[model samples]
Target chain A: MHREDFPMLKKDIIYFDNGATTLKPQCVIDSVVEYMTNHTSNIHRGDYDAAVITNKLYDNVRNIVSSFVNCDSREVIYTSGATQSLNMVVFGYMKKHLKKGDEVLLNKAEHASNILPWIILSKQIGIVIKYVPLDNNYELTLENIKRCVTFKTKVISLAQITNVIGDVRDVYNIGKFCHENNILFNVDGAQSVPHMRVDFKNCYMDFLSFSGHKMCGPTGVGILVGRYELLEDMDPLCYGGGMNSYFEENGDYELKSIPTRFEAGTTPIAQVIGLGEAIKYLMKIGMDNIHEHEMKLKQYLLDKVKDIPNIIVYNTSSNSGIFAFNIDGVFAQDTSIYLNSYNIYVRAGNHCAKELKDEINIKNTVRVSMYFYNNYNDVDRLVDALRNSKDIFKIVL
Target chain B: MDNDLRREIIMDNYNDPMNKGLIDDNSYLKTRTSSESCIDDLSFMMKIENNIIEDIRFDGEACAISTSATSIMIRILIGKTVDEAKKILNNYKNMIEEKDYDKNLLGELAVYDSISKQPNRKNCALLPNRAINNMLEELNKKNN
Candidate 1:
């Protein structure tokens, strides 16, 4: 497919940093601009024709996301981003159920967004934070999780696919185990939801969170999917104008129904509407085809870089669209600088998971993440650049 | 003459860095600074004798720009008084910020003038100066 469909890719730039955020298609951008220019109105409040159209569009986006994830429309709660969605689950669920002396199980490979919030909550509530260690291949195993879980384990928060390494975990089995033990399961789907097929119903997950921007949608929008009954019992993260129904001088106040009850204050209406268009674009392309296209490019790059002496590739088993590696005897930032000279964009450093870096025994690595828009030609260009980098810069590698 | 000399200066210093290591514990004030965002670390040691900078040394893992910048900076600061060293550091910072820099005052440091063109690498080139300024701040705190 021609990249002209995405206006941002026309800048003579090779974009491989899709893990950070993907470039939005023209359709998604046009949807957002069209909404902002023409049908912009405050949803769920105003009574004019504009408000009616806005409400329908906003709620329709929710329905699109619900079908995308195979969940109920009422189960999806919109937030600022995945970070807020994660914090909502950690704080909202922990406040309702967990107490001092409870333990929340986590994996060593979790991003800071997934781990730090739970750590802060544990400190505040006096709950213990435990970790399930990754195997030698950087895969989280059921045996390791079973070993980590204790009788006091109240919650298990883990990434469905590690953001940096892109290793997929068996969240289905993990969720089943958590449910059997009466422990709440929270899956960080920020990386997985964009690249793979996620069925919340089949996975039996208690809570799953993902961001829109990573899926070729607009930023400032995310979805937290959970069971409707559970969401009804949990308190909203924020309380303000949109979430509450009736307020009085007394401390007691009545809150709105599910979804709206969880979403407080003003929403990212334009971005959400654009995200709905993004979903439609992805659906038209089909997730399975997108996944296959990225995997083929990833494998091609992996094969080409495998024989390059002194190059250490992280996560050889990752079928997802991310390649993390480092040139031996060269700082990752230096290598990234060399790549940037050729207009090839890649991410370097710890990738927001300092704990994962420690677990992997590397301070930082260069990451070349791919999207459906990327192809084998991009991979070959990266390889050619890598081969010529030392000779071009006259820097001994 | 200006552009060629600038590149030459930076390359020369990067190839052969001077005063690159730690000093004895009692010899001078020392501080360790690092860029966690980029994972760069440097340990800087300065030896002061009677209010004069007798010597300066740095040892750490960093990009070429930072390593070379430290090498050239120590060469300029050595044998200068404390106030003079501070002035030179300020001038070099201004040079990296694309200010009107004096070539005669910069000496070998003139080679780094082109670094201003690459704004992101400016932090790497200025790492040593940041440590020096931070060290001066600590010394001032002690004196006050």
Candidate 2:
């Protein structure tokens, strides 16, 4: 692949922070810039030619995203980001569906974005929130889920791939269980959608949310894919001009259809169009190829760091892009600083999954997340830098 | 990589931290705090007898600046009166905040004077001092 496709990568920088947000491809950027500069218009509103073009482009991107996740366009709803999508599901659904004494089952390995919304909702409504403990390897097992679920269980929210440990769960099996028990299954796909292939139809999930920036697109755009019937039943999160069809003088208003009902006024049209271009780019490269490339880099890094004594590697089962580890005696932040001196960038905190660190009994671990753009040479450079700074970056036993 | 930002003593102490364990007895007051964003936790213990700090110990996991700052703090705080310790804590805070700190009084803390240059790590270096001040406040509240 041509590295020039991504203008951000041209700057002598080895960005290993893809898990935070990915570098936008030139195709995606051009798509966004074209829309912003030339064809800019309020979508689904004005009757002008520009507005018509804008509406088609916006809806086409929605169709593209729906196809990317193997769902219908009606199933895809745009939000500010994955966090907003998650909050929309938790708050929007719980307010309408969950009754007092209902239970929400969650995994201990969930990101704060996935967990905190449910936690807050549980506090607001009288729903009981319970956690399914991970096994020795930080994997959420069916057995654990069975132990955690009860008759009062109304929903099960989990991360498809843990941001910190890269532990991928069996969302299909979990979805099966939830469906069998009449529970709503919500999957946080922020970390998984970028590096892995996700088929909503095959997964049998009721709801799934993913951010665009994590998948080589621009920020401020995310998708929440939910079952058509379920989304129709759930109330809209935000009330606004775009979402309402007609309003009577006596406070009576008809809401727009699904997807638009959820999307409030002024959607991120340009970014969503750019996200479509991003999805097209990924489709050309193939998600499986991206997965294979990332796995190769992950294995290369693991192999290089394995022989180094006093180095702690987290999540060896990571088939995806995330690699979480710590130098034996060195603090994660210090190790990150030392690596930064070499122009290699890796996230060194809990990666916004605060509960996972405590659940895994780690204070902090350095995380090096891979992307399709990263190659073996990048891994080699990282290994060389780590090897050279063993004394400064190693933790004392 | 700025010369003024890098602390040689802080790095040395981080590599080889001193007084890095919990005090066994309950004679000392203990305060624990952690940075949720960075996931670094720190615990401070001051063994005070007759209103004088006899010994100090720290136990936690943190960055180089934090570990080294704690080590340097415990080393300097031993055998000082409570009032004197508060004065030293204030001086250390001022130094990290780039305020006009008395050069002669802040002896070993001068090693960390460059900490002002690295703004992000400034909180890590001041964790121990914050814990001490918080502990003193709690002690005063209890006495009242």
Candidate 3:
């Protein structure tokens, strides 16, 4: 819909790898460039013109994030990306609170970022990592989660929308369930936050993690929003100059409060500024519009390929814009290569969900993940390339 | 190299691979290699007697580049001594890395000359070659 907002549209490419990272809008890019070119100074320390500008931009991002996610600004913490955010949740918070044998419910559809931290935590503490089985459509239903829930299930951690399957998990209902059951709810919003409106307060989430790059912001920035009380208990995974309030030679140091304490040292000021711009850009166009456009695109692509005998789609019933498919005998990478020949970029292979192989029964699939910027022409090009995939080998070599 | 010729080389080697299965023999040293990113998990088995690679076989799910490259690699390394195979694999590595490699030495492996352009696929083309190369290096170490 807002295709013109993205500068990459000027290029001769059809980018369908938004599941990995979205194309940055001109406004987002300009924000970063402007920050670097003009106000190239460290945030929060200086009272000078540049520092004031940078600090205002950086600090105000918390409000932007809070407004976007419907969280308190005090609850927002900045990290490298979703991976780091999830790590802080597991190591910083869960490791301290979760006792041995406490079960954390997860699914195979989650990206490694969400799963690996808990797996590592399981190794550290005697936490039991349990996989809530996916349904026949490979969707994680609340019913399956309910069945897996035991008294020992201390946490229910999941992606709001899976990367490969693109199933929009009912985080609202699941969050309510967790709230009622007195379980900690951690939502990996890496796939969800970019596409839809996620009400962190209303969802009753204890923690939420998401990246900036996947939402048209620059890399090296992400938001980690924890509940206010939980933020007080959570220790910083990283510690240095900015986060500390006082230090003495007697091996004693006092750290800052809630969110700032978690954000140790110099944060990605430019990236944070870029992220704020990205969020503002997104809100202007509206989240509901983005989601609706993606669903429409998904259905359009599905209906077009349903008749093609050799084309096998994995997630026809999935709720998002992701399309996982392959030509009958072609390898996922091979299909991706063929599509690249037509200047259409898509992700291929395990897609960082290595455990998904056991559930889907196939090791790899070419994934075409759409964003709001993608239009009908992009899909038509992909379809045309798929139709002419007999020459895949010819081009791939 | 013509694009059609390259396609034929890859497709031919992929469709009908050489010694495409591992034997349950005690003498054959085998190793399974796969990327956590891609789906290719090939078990490469080798039998070496007095420094010569008597047999080499591989079996797994892989893309055309990986399968075809592995097949062609097996054909090239079989019956060659450990040292010779090392030299050939070094040349193949050189070629894959876009370093100065002997043009005539590669023969059929020359089809992947353009693989460096698609750097992402370089791992796929080099997977089995690297495994077999490591085996040869180990054999060289033990024998020397």
Candidate 4:
């Protein structure tokens, strides 16, 4: 665990809310601060020293992202976050290509960012939205997806790893299936890319969306990597000076190509530069090593919590480090409050996966999502706190 | 903070809440409310006869504070007139906001007197009050 890299770890608290966002590493913060302090200038416009430095640092992130996610640099589109990226995919591309009555396959475990835009699209056009059911383990396997697919299934969009269940979907197999069937594949990498190696080319993904903040970078910057051909077909959700080549008074204009066209406005320049540094940081640490560490930590937490009888643990078999649980008779918020009293931070609620109740039969849960920075001490602290949750009301009251 | 009194009242009311179920009566007015941030979803029903709060009931899943507070609230409002209930609500809101209020009027409701300190739980403490206040507004509109 690279705990020392994150200044937040020095605080007397155990943060297990990585599903929401991870704590930023010092290098990422320093990079952003350095840009704001020393070399602050608008990108791709000026030839001054500050502007040159800014443009180089900002533009170079495309290569960094391409290498990080294994996609062409020309295909990388800077966005506000995964939410905006997803919106661009659904409204910008899918709206035009997918006609009325065409079906899109989704699952209940998907976060709202992945589901809501499609729902809006279904309402606007007449596209049919179908949900593939999760198996007994609350997982979406390729078999389940296959059962839900029809000839009209034009698209299959899913999170590579679900935020709540933390179960990894076989997107590679699903992508291959889509490729053969000529169906479009959109991967919500918000919960996947940061923790593991995601090869966009190998997976045959047409679209991939991920936020920088989730991977220990700054907020307000995200990456959307689309297949080059599809990116050429996609439209920018925004329009401004940065993305245009030339314009005429009669509204006749030429926009830039592929990725540049999609990133229309003045982008979050500092955050993007910081995100590049964060990607390099994660690369140095090794995605496989980060993933392996998380799995081990998840297993350790599962084993340690076994002795606590009244604790109702959910998704014990999830491949990722997200652990959802509740003290049998206690409310999730009460547990969260009780834990907060002890400096243990966990997320408590629907977690924006509102439709997940159909699968889990519960509306709310206390989620403890981890990053590689987490260690055994954090789990021990959590178990110790949970073991005394009987005295929860004592602290909460 | 009245820790002892608050703890005792909360435990008793939460374990076995008063008026914790809805009636099948057609005359009563009901409304359901849920918190967007937390899991405090509760439904409230009130029967007002001749400007008096004849009876009230609530049913659903909520945190201990929400359940216990609603339990205490329904118990207090059962036999009170509509005007009296409004006064109680006003005073309760005042207390929740950490403003000057008559605490004797709150009785068991004062258990959440210090809830303002736990700013995050203020909504949890007031979720029931919000729903009941809606019922009050509807009743007031009908009466006018």
Candidate 5:
């Protein structure tokens, strides 16, 4: 499995919290270290050899990102993280174009970043917010989307794969529907881009956002891929030295072109280069192979944990490598703490998708997310830890 | 459990928690507190008459350590005057933090003798006691 690539795995623990952030490989680390050690100069500013090399490596990440998502390099916008990317779209595009009485459609399964920005905008302007209905399993179906759409529906924003529930959403079909109906479509690709292959043109997405850290890249680097025509129409969220073409004393300034204008201050040069290396590493392994490995692990884990006596599984139909569940009488946090004592790490709480609390009818649950590095032995260790936890909880109660 | 402190007294209180319910009376002083890192949501209510804590109750969703700590705390607080309650609270905090304190004075709270070793659970064990300390301050202000 590519477990040896991550140095932190030497510590005795079964890491099942990959949905929060992934462990970076040695090649990605080396890329960042190489840049910092040798070519530690500003890009696009100096005429020296170091600066030229820096600029080339920095600009090359755009091509890497574009090819990773199957979009043109000019459409790839560098950002601090997915949060910043989503905010740019919210403040830069939606705030300007979406008017009062217009509607924005979302669902309960979306991450907080996707929903909160729209909520703030809806309150600021008198824009109405609506939700796509869900079935018994809290899944957003295509029929539900059609049923929820209104004449005033102007935008549809959702996650490619929800973090908590781990359901693989058919965003491509949804994007096609949005195009035919003349509505803007935005995809939160933070969870999906790291796990599976995503094609920008095939999905017909107007805008997509994702973080690099969740895909074995550095923490501060991410990408926002937008159609060139739409990106040209939107304004920049920040103004600074690098993004400007010319300036006058009377506050008059000519700004740079689309992607450059959107990236305001000093960019994350080392992290972006590291992300380019990460994208190459992922492509070399093949996204299909990674996806298949993850599914096998997921199936193995589910089959083993399903018959556990007091375990209550919340997401039975999830296609992704995330499992959300809890023991009958034990609190989610307590269970996670118990497992932690056995050198197993998992996430507990509402998992930042607090809006889904009422729908799921539980305030908290434990989440175990897996990645390509995780294998069946890790699953066995977790199952054994969970089984032993019951005996300990009896006395600790 | 590997640790005796987690096994014996903490577990005893968690399994059969005392003073856990809602007091609907208007005379009770009520407050709520929660921790962000874990599920430690709690609601506290105390009935104080004549500067004495006649009754105290807690109700919430929390982990074993937090729930058990609050349960053990309410048992030690009932029927004690505000001043005595404050003294016990300080002593119990000292005991859990492994500072020198009169072990006999802490009573059932001395069960947390080895809590200092588990640094992360210190907040879990002290949250409700801290809430009660706040309640005591509010009562003192009212009396003043």
Candidate 6:
């Protein structure tokens, strides 16, 4: 809706790889620049004016994130990205609670960041990692989760919106189920939080993780919001200077409280401040409006591409703005290259979810993901590019 | 035509790759490789008898650049000695990287000379060659 806010849009590029990361808005950029240029000092350690301002701005971001996700600021923890946030949960909580023979149910289509940590923990601790079976469309439903759950199921981890399939899962319902069954609900909001408004308190999520870069903020910053009791019980994934309240001479240490306890050493102060600005920017535009715009653009693109011949679409029915497809007899990377010749950008390959190779029975596919800045003209450009690329197969074969 | 994106020779070989099947014989030394950036997954199989390349085959899914480069590679490696095949693979890589190389030795792989300018497709052109080098290394270790 506010394309002008992103300076990258002014360039001659039609970026459709928003699922990988979104273009940063000018307000986010300006905020980061302002921090770097004027308020350039470490937080929580210095007594200088810049340092105090930095510390105040840095700590206040937690409240911004808390209000954004409808969670308590004390529960907000800063991480490197969603990857680190997920690692903290697996290593911090699940590693301790899940025992041998305890099962953790996950979706087959979850991103690698969501699946790999659990897999590593399962291997290390002898916990059983199981998948909630998908229906024929390679889609998961609450019914599938109900069918998969057992008495031994200790945790349920899934992406609120899967990166590849773009399925907007009924995570609220699933979270309620987890609460009733005493199972920990971990939501990988890497794909969903930026696109939709998340009510962390109402969703019954024990933990929620999302990255800043995916929502018009800078990279290397993410949020991990957990229930206060759960976070208090969870061990710190990292240990260092600022995270501890006191330390003994013989190597004993009393850690700080939640949020600060998890965020050890120096944090990405500028990026986190920029993330706060990004959240405000999104809120100003209204998240519902942004979501409605994406759905409209998705429907428009789908309507245009549906008539293209010799195409295999994996998830056209997805309400989210991800279109995964492959042209018949053409490799996904080749199609991506052909599109690149037209100044179009799209993601191709298994998309880093290697375990999904067996479930979907397809090696690779091209993904065209959209964001709020994208419109029908970009979709038209992609359609024209695809139509023109048909000649490459003809010339080659 | 985007000359950098698609060359006629690349397309021809990609559409009709040579030696594009795996060897069933257990005697063939095999190794697989994939590019981290692109979807270029390939396996190279070679049957070297007394240091001479008796047979060579490649079988895997890859991008057009990789498939075509691999097809051209099989043609040059089928009848050469092990050391000679290694030399040719090395020279082909040097050529792709825009290094000094004997043009006559590269054969049809010389078409990949422009790949040096296209940085992203460089891995696509190198996937099968790297697999070949890896397979040779494994074979040498076994014989030693």
Alpha-carbon TM-score of each model against the true structure = 0.91, 0.88, 0.95, 0.95, 0.92, 0.96
- Segments in model 6 whose C-alpha atoms lie over 4 Å from true places: A393-397, B1-8, B23-26
Candidate 2: misplaced stretches above 4 Å? A393-397, B1-8, B11-37, B43-59, B74-94, B97-99, B129-144
Clash-forming residue pairs, model 5: A397-B15
lDDT of 5 by residue, A44-81 (tens): 78999999999998999899988889999999999988
What is the C-alpha lDDT profile of model 4 across A73-151, one tens digit per residue?
9989899999999999999999989999999999999999999999999999999999999999899999999999899
Clash-forming residue pairs, model 6: none
Report the TM-score measured on chain A for model 5.
Answer: 0.98
lDDT of 1 by residue, A237-349 (tens): 78898999989998888999988998888899998998899888988888888888888988898889876777789888977888899887667888888888888899887
Clashing pairs in 4: none
DockQ winner among the candidates? 4
Which digits, one per residue and each the tens of the lDDT, describe model 6 over residues A1-397? 7888889999888999999999999999999999999989987899999999888888888999988999999999999999999999999988877799999998789899988998898789999989888777777899999998999999999989888888888888999999999999999999898998888999899999999999999999999999999987899878888999999999987988877988888999999999999999988887788888889998888888778898888887777888889999899987887787778889998887777777778879999988889988899999888777668654332
Model 6 alpha-carbon miss at residue A194, Å: 0.6
Ranking by DockQ: 4, 3, 6, 5, 2, 1
Which regions in candidate 1 have their CA more than 4 angstroms from the true location? Answer: A392-397, B1-61, B74-80, B104-107
Ranking by lDDT: 4, 3, 6, 5, 1, 2
DockQ, model 1, C-alpha based: 0.41
Q: In lDDT terms, how accurate is model 3?
A: 0.91
Cα lDDT for residue B9, model 2?
66
lDDT (10s digit) by residue, model 2, range A45-154:
78999889888988998788888889988899999889999988988876788988999888767889888888787778778888888888887888899998877888
DockQ-derived CAPRI band for the predicted complex in model 6:
medium
* Model 4 chain B: lowest-lDDT 10 consecutive positions: B30-39
* Model 1: residue B128 alpha-carbon error in angstroms: 2.6
- For model 3, residues B15-125, the per-residue Cα lDDT tens digits are 999999778897888788886656677888899988788999888789999999999988988888877888889899999999999978788999988899988889998
Q: How many residue pairs clash in each candidate?
A: 1, 5, 0, 0, 1, 0
Candidate of highest TM-score? 6
Question: What clash count does candidate 5 reach?
Answer: 1
